[model samples]
Every structure is written in C-alpha cells, then in structure tokens.
Target: MLIKHLIGAAVALALGANTVMAAGFASLGEGLTPLGGEKSGNQAGTIPAWNGGITQPPAGYQGSGKPHVDPFAADKPLFTITKANLDQYRAHLTPGQIALFDTYPATYQMPVYVTRRSGSAPQWVYDNTRKNALSAKLADGGNGFTEAYGGIPFPMPKTGVEAVWNHIARYRGEYVVRRASEVAVQRNGSFSPITSQQEAMFKFYDPKGAYADLNNVLFYYLSFIKSPARLAGSAVLVHETLDQVQEPRQAWAYNAGQRRVRRAPSLAYDTPIPAADGLRTADDTDMFNGSPDRYEWKLVGKREIYIPYNNYRVSSPDVTYKQLLQAGHLNPAYTRHELHRVWVVEGTLKSSARHVYSRRTLYLDEDSWQAAVVDQYDGRGELWRVSLAYLKNYYELPTTWSALDVFHDLQARRYHVQNLVNEEGGTIDFSQAPPEDSEFKPAALRRRGLR
Candidate 1:
C-alpha cells in the first residue's frame, strides 16, 4: 500500500469508529435499492426512482457499433435556466455551474429535460455488486482494495472515500474501442480537433475476474493521436491500478517526435495534461482519477439535483460539431439536464499533499455510481473548473456511461469536450470483444507509433 496505514488500520483518522463496519449487506434490501439507489424517489415527482433500466434499444433502433440516434430527439426542453433567473434555481445549481453563468451571462445556459432513470447493467454485474457489498473493504487509506472485482466496490457506501471508490470501480464493460476527438475550444469558439483512436481493457470490470485476479490493476488504456501534424504519432499507454500503495499507476508515452518509449510518472496528480494547453490536470481526465491519498474525503450526504442524463443527442451523427460547441459551453440546446439523486462527496487537500486543486466535490449518480458533475476548486477555495458528463445506455452491453465529457475553466474562459465522434463514422464500436493483453504493452505502443 502507498500509505503506511489503511482506513481499516487507522479507523479514527479515516472515518469515525462508528462507521468502520457501517454498511453491512443487510441494508441492501430495506433502505437501499438492489442497484444501490434509494428505494424511493424524491418526495416531489420531479425525479423518478430507478426501476428496470434501459436494457434494449428504443423503437427503430439499428444494431450495435452504429451511431446512437437520440431516442428522445423529439422531446423538447421543459425549461431553460439562465443568468436572468439565477435566484430561482440556486438550490439545484452547484457553485461552479452558477459561476459559469456569472462569467458568461449571455452565452452559458442549461436546458432542463424530464427525468429518466434508464441505465442498467448486465445481470452478472448486479450480482457481483451485491457480492461486493458484503466482501470488499478498503486498504492503505482508500488507495487500495481487497475482496472486490467486476462490480461497484461499495454499493452501500458509508463514507466519502467509499463513494468515490464506487465511481472508480463502476462497471463500463470489459473492453471498448472508439474513434473520438477532444477539442479545447478557445474563448471565440474556435478549436482544432485533437483526434485519436483509443482502446481499453477494463480488467477490473471483467465479469470473469475475481478480486484475487486483479493484482492491483484497474484498466489498460492506449491512445494514439491522429490529427493535426503537430501532435500526430504521439501515443499514451496507461495501466491504471487499484492500489498505489502496492504499485502506482504504470504509464508510458511513445513520442513520435522523439521516437522513444519512456516511463511517464507525470501522468498522475496535478501534472498539466499533454495536449490540454494547461487547462486541465492529469487527474482531472475522468472527472477525478489517480489516488485519494492526497486529500481527506468526506461524504457530504445525498441530494436531488439536475444533472446531465440520457444525452444521446450530443453524440448523434445528425448533430454537427458547430451546433454543439459554443464559446463558453456546449450549446445548451443540445445539452440535457434532469433531476436525479446523487451521492455528494468532498475532497479537501491534506496539508502534506502537494496538488493544484485544494478542494473538489463530485456528484455521483446513485444508480450507476458515475461521477456526473464535478466542481474543482483552486488553492484559495475558489471554484475554478466545472465538469459535466452526460450518461447514456450502451444497450448492447446494457451499461451506462459518459456520452460526452465537458471540462470548463472559469478563469480561462476555455474548455474541452472529449469523446466527440459525430463526424467519425461510428460513434462507439461496442460489438468488439476484449483486447489481448499484448496489445496494451509498451512495446506494442512503440510498434503502433512507428506504423
């Protein structure tokens, strides 16, 4: 383990002694729903509780690996939230979301849609998550895990760290391959496509793998940039691990310019991302990543809020890039927000932890344990960046995840939206099977880079 003491070892420092054994499997049926969502929806009818999620495609659906046409394309926005009516919806808006409107009063807005609780996983996954609730436990100050694999580690989460762990360990299928683009849109709405072809093997989420089989690895990722001559031929390979205390994340970069394969320790924590131009940090890639060792995570309880949901529209081939990318944010018309209950967790930087973000709060969707909304704060405790992820169901796998991820910088008036493939032929090819282990190896990256 990276830390000398685990949460189970130092119960007093991690969580109160009362919470050490808080979430027993008994709570799953009574208070918590089977999928870890609240059994009952909110008191108001605005948000509906999750029943059986969207396991099949809508009417007129094409086969997998094709473009995902929005099922709700005909639906209209229930209402629009803007700077002019900030006071009316302050209760549902995060500090970061409100800041965006304040910064770009005329441009930034949110189009609210009706709530839809339609995201489900395979039967084996739900069974594994239930099993994990009874067996999984934290290690080395929440940096490692024991007795968990192929499921949400902490379905009945009792603390903040556990909630975040659920997000990191959430199911996203065993493997995937896609052609996508990331655009760091400038203030004037002009941007170049930092396009790439990417593949991942979610070994930890592999249904057949057991906790003992993980060996501390989470997933194997490879990204090869394919656009704009300046950044082409550069590739990154990451073997994300569960426990940094045992073995930290293994990352390597094959730089076409240098023609070398070198170990990359700088891909974690506060390091500026390679192609983001200093707008985002390495750990900021998936809303929150790397390790939770540098901060004190606190479970801030649950709340009902409007978040990005069922955003298939943004990924539709019919929607052009120009219509989606705005000066400060994605065109609000294409964005869809709906009310959902989420687990709120806050991470405050430890005094000894050296990182750029002092405090960050993540809003995790209760149904999927996905970090739907993230508010990252600077050293001065001021909100600096806001991230929103629109979740949609991959009907073939019956898994739900981000269709588009937008990271906005409040101070710079710049942002990046990754996983955009409207112009690409296929949105995301889910029909492919798990990749071979050799494909993610460092030598493979070199060969692929040279090719």
Candidate 2:
C-alpha cells in the first residue's frame, strides 16, 4: 500500500508538470505565437498588447443599461506593434499582410478560454451566472419569464416573406413580455409584468432600448461548426464556425459597374479558380458584414489562447500575421491577453494572379470561429485594408454568434461600418434562407436598388 501511494504521487506530479508545459507552449503551428511578444511573461509588466476590458462602462459593457466592471485589470497589455520593425516578423505570416491589431485588440487577440474543454452546456454558463448576484438582474427567470413577460418564446430568423408570420409570433410572445417587464420595473420601481401592447411597442421601437437581447447565445450556437458537408452550388461558408442562421445563407456580390448582384459560386476546399482578368474571384459568401461576396476565405488552423469579448476571455486563433504584411508596416495592438488561442485563416482572390490585395489575413476566434480581424494588401504589396467584426451573445436563441458591428479601412480613404440587432415585433427570419439561386442575381440587385 505504501509503495502504491508513492507511485501515484509521483505520477500526479509528472502529469501536473506536463500540463503546465503544454499550456506554456500551446502553439497552433510553427510560426504563430501568443499575443505577447514573448511566449512567457517575466517580472517586468505584462508585455504591451491589446486590452479589451479597459474601456469605460458605457463603452465596454452593454445590456439593461447597467455598467459592469473589468476583472482582469491587473493583466493589462504591455506592448503593441507599430510602423517600426515590422520587417523582422514577416516570415511568420501565412497571408503576408500587416493589419491594425492594437486598434481592435479584442478582434486580433486569440481566445484561450474557447479551447478549454467544458463539460457544461454553453447556455448553462450564462444561466448560472444570471442566477448569481452580478447577472441575476438581467435574468428573465428563463423561458417562463421570457414567455409570460418578455413576449416571444423563441427568436425567428431574419429573412424573406414567410418571416412576417415569425415576426408576429415573436411580437405576441417575447416582445410583449419584455415590454411588460420594463414598464413594471419603472412603475412600481421593481420587476413588473408587461400589461399592454402599446407599452411593448414603445420598448420595441425605442432606439435607446433593447428589443431583444440575443448576442452570446447566438454565438454559442455558431461555435458548433464541425466539418459540415459543402452545399450544392452554394458557396462554402468557410473561415469562422458556421452556427448562425445568417451564417450559411447564400449571397450575391454586388457589381457596382453592372448595377447588379451576381450569384457567387462556391469553391471547393483549397480549390483555386482563375478570374477572367487573370485575377481570382472572392469565393466565400454569407450574410454577416453587409452580405456575402464581399470577402473570400481560406482555411488556416486551430489552436488556443486568450481573446477580448464583453468581460470574459477565451483562447483561439492558430495562424499568425507574419506572412501577410507589407515590407514595413507594424501591428498597433500587441497585448498579452490578446495572444490567446486562435485559428489563423487567409482570404484572397481565388487565383493568385490578379487581386487588389494579393493576400488577406484573418484571425478567427477558436471557440466561436468568428472572424475577428482581417488585413488586406494592395497589388504593390502595400498594406491596404483592415477589417474588424465584433461578436455579441444572444440569450433567447441560445448557442449562436452574431456580429454587433463591423468596420473596414482602406488606402483610398474608403471605410464601412454596420450594426445588427433583433427588433421587437420586427419582421426578420434568418432560418428559412431564400432558395440558393433565387435572390442572388443581377436582376435582384436592380430590383432592390442596391446597385
């Protein structure tokens, strides 16, 4: 018995050592490193990198019009990449472009928590937190309160004509309930039940209010992408995990010159297609960020680390930006927490022969597989564009990821931004996406006056 006990102790110690080593060197591949400049930290302050939790209350925390505090204030970033010394890190890039990392550290830093194996359902995490003091105020007592008080029991997808019914059901079910809760809270100075439709409508359309809160849950669902089969004639929704209704919906790329939207073709995994002008066509499509056809995608890899989102941190992103930078541009954000786990991906024109940017680099959140930041290059190998997408959780939908906002930068001083929301009594159904080729044509763009 004594001998056995000694052996067990020895094994336990060995295992603990191994785990520590593994965590320290959890690289996605040969080139990628943690968001920090060094793999490990020293006595000096944590290496400067992007810090997401630092922003003030109104800027960082959202929901119930309440403010939340940052938990990792001590772990703030120590450094960031700049115009200087960008060349020294070129060999590490898979897409070969330098992007603005510090400008949006939450988007660039890989998340490590995503890689942590959690036996608990993602919904339970939020649910349990809500039952606690901090999050309890936001909890609507689960499905019962949501249905009896909030309005709709379930969220409907945002899409087409059939969506009209979905909107009505949601309005009657969830929206009504939410408004009641809000009015009761105001009138009695405590949580009250919604009693009227007009009150609900007021809450539904009020720009300063929340019609529906569904960001995290939606992202949780979207994180389930796992080698889904490619669709017929439908562009492969590659890059981030495909978990949302808006994720796989077909899209038409708008051709401004022709004043039309063309149905984009789906390309096989890693299969390159040549463009008519010897350039490559952007091959991926989906609904986030304007529409599909706005960008192309290439599979990178899976790995682990910390990332910036709301108040918590996670690990993801396996690829690095070493290969995708111009000769001398630097990444502005380079904090420690942002160097968590991630899946590095590449997006470019199908054929390498012709493209405004020969290559683009994307850092996808490993847990959610959502594209956080993208760096694009010009034909002359100059850094041209940088894009960022923010993910928010959805409580009602449960297990899905949705974009809160999207931003883009360009050499020609052109830029774009967008925000998404689920409006109360609003008619938007994403579940039943239009038939594959139905709305993705030149005539469709003209009819909608988008072109």
Candidate 3:
C-alpha cells in the first residue's frame, strides 16, 4: 500500500481541490467540527451549521426499534425545482439531477427544502475520530489505510482518493440488522421484489476492537434472500476489507437449489449484482461501494447540490408500493430534497480496469460522508445511469445512512431501489453488539443454508 505524509496547502493546490481544516488532531472540535462538517453556518441562513443530530428520536418516536416519526413533518419545501425552473438552480444541481428532468420533464421534480446538517454519532465516535486524525494515513495506491480505527479516517482529506476514503470509512453504526427489499421497476411501473434479511457489523466501529485487531477487515455482511420462489434461500456472505489491495474481499455464496456453498470472487467491481435485475452494478450498491483500485479519483472541490436529506416522509409507514413507485421515478410528493454542501469527486476508469462505468462523478455529503448522488457513464462517454440515496437519521445511533437507494438507468427507463420498507414496521436493529467472527465463515454459510 502506498501512503504519503504530505499534509498542507501545496498538496491541495497540486490536487486542484480546496483544503479544509488544518492538519493534526488539535484542529478538530476547535476550528474543525466533529465529523468534519463546517462549524459556521452559510451566509444566507439557508444551510444551518452542524448541531448535535437527532440523538433522541422525535417526540412521538417509540424508541430504537420502532418506525421513526418525521421530525420535519410540518416543515414545507422552500421551492420546487422542475425542468421549467431548473436553469435557475442548474449550478447547484448535479448532472444526474438535471438529467432526470430531461428524461421525465413533467413527472420528475425535486422538492427542495432548507438544508439541515443533522449528522451525528456517539461521543465515543467523536473522540475516536479526533484520535484517528493524528494517525490515519493512506494505504497503497489509496485503496486502503492504516493507523485508523473507528471514526472518520482522514478528516482534512487532501487528495481525491483521500476524500473517497473518508466516504468509504464513514461510520454508519457499530452493528445493524435490516429487513428490506430491493425492487427493479420497469417502464410501466410494474416491479418485482427481492426481499432479504441483511446484517452488517462495522468492525471499524467496534469499541472493543483496537486498531491492531481489525485485521484489514472493515465490515462483515450477510444477506439472506427471503422471497420469490426462484430466488428464495439464496444467501451471500462478504468479509469487506479495510485494505482490499493487500487482500481481496472474501465472498461466499450459498445456492438454495444446488445446496452448495462456494467462494464467489466476482462480488466486487462492475459485476451485475447477484440479487439486482440488471439495472445496477456491485460498486453502485451503496451509491458507490468497493475498491478504488480501478479508477483514478480526483477532488473537484465542494459544491451546493439539491440532495435527498432528512427524508422521514419517504420512510413513513403510511406509504405503500402502489403509492410510492411510479413509471419514471418515485412519487415526487412523497420525496424531499434539500440544498446542502457536498464534496464533489470524479473517478475516471483506469485503462487496465475492466468495468462498465467509464467514468463516475460522486457527490459525498459534507457532514455524513455518504453519497447523495452519483453520475455513471458508459464506455462511449455517454451518461448511462444516475444513482440517488435518500438519507435519514437512524436516530438512536444518531447516524445518517440510506433509507432508500435508487439506481436509475436513463437508457432503459428502469430503476432499482433497495431498502423500500415504508409500509413495514421497524426494519433496522442497532444492537450495539458486534457479530461473532464465526458467523461470517464459509462453514457458517453452509450451516445457515437451507438443505
């Protein structure tokens, strides 16, 4: 792994990106706010500065396991951005956002509201991030890092890859289990659901595990498909690594029909996702996930973009599949967008890397390090797909993650959205207890597979 120790204005100038907080641990929580969000509010008062996020769920919320109530249910959109008025907001909108209008001018619209910087983590997380600032350095070719555990790895990121790393290493929670569905919708708004029970244990956030104990693994994931006769009982296991360059991700798949568990090295990169119909790629799963080994990422400076944020209405239990899903996009009235600051990073596929996306433009939320929108290009340099993530606070953990992640294929007029359980109750569990290492092994995959 290639890691450099250059932290200064020179690196920023060379990389063609704006440098944020000063180098070192002392700057955090002082001049630099926790989680790397700007401490001061924007001049226009449209975007407020970071305050402690929703530590306690909204007043009516039934605690950690219940459906989260919309804290901003009474709040209204400041204005709506459509194709007619898009030009005025063009500078602030990502190319993906603008393309949606061109594709569905009449139906696709963004209900933009005031930006709320509500990203927060536990106090221990903040403390760990401050310590990580002093030690975390890039790994070989910038695909991995060392000397950092828990917290944001590089708060004052200098390179484009560093910014990407920050997004990859961002905290979701210590451990979480979710029951959700991934649906692929066709042009006529007809859809088929792929429901699954998934568990993720972020070893990076394991308070008991120290830096040395991480063993290059960031998280362990298991997805067990629960429905559809043809796909039922299919399961996937992944041991996502901290340094994928040194050791590739360890993946295993259990075939319900075959009754066999086998190693699946093809889980990463641009491979069509196993459960997804053909609309999305493996790396496109988390808006943008997996290895950075195939692309040359560049920091393009920060910009204000109208992105999905604090979207409780989208996650409200009142919505149903019939009401939420539409031909070209989700029901606009049920979605919410906010004008917020985001770090723009572009990835150009390497000549040697064999992948579908020739180029990708990623917009990472400044406060949460989550991808708000990603523009994907085909080999011919034509815009092919756009990915959007509706972010909401998992209030008890006080972390922001995708409530629903949608990947729209512009050419096909189709899209795939994961985690659409609005009509269902209590889909996420933050047990604060990490999974045992035994559960992620191949033997366990076989044991858990239905015979």
What 10-residue stretch in candidate 1 is worst by lDDT?
A: 1-10
Scored by lDDT, model 1 comes in at 0.79
TM-score of each: 0.92, 0.33, 0.93
Comparing candidate 1 with candidate 2, which one achieves the higher TM-score? 1
TM-score of 2: 0.33
Candidate 1 structure, TM-score to reference = 0.92
Q: In model 2, state the lDDT of residue 48.
A: 30
lDDT of every model, 2 decimals: 0.79, 0.27, 0.79
lDDT of 3 by residue, 1-451 (tens): 0000000001211122234433434556765577776767778888786767666777887766578888888888899998899889999888888899999998999998877777777888888877776667777868888888888877767678878888888888877877777678889999877677778888888888888998888888887777766777778888888777788877877888888888775566776764456788777878877779899999898898889998877767788887888998999999989888888999999998889999999999888889999999999999999999999888788888888988899999888888877755666888646658898788988778664
* Off by more than 4 A, model 1: 1-31
* Model 2 bad stretches (over 4 Å): 1-298, 302-308, 311-337, 352-358, 379-382, 391-406, 420-451
TM-score of 3: 0.93
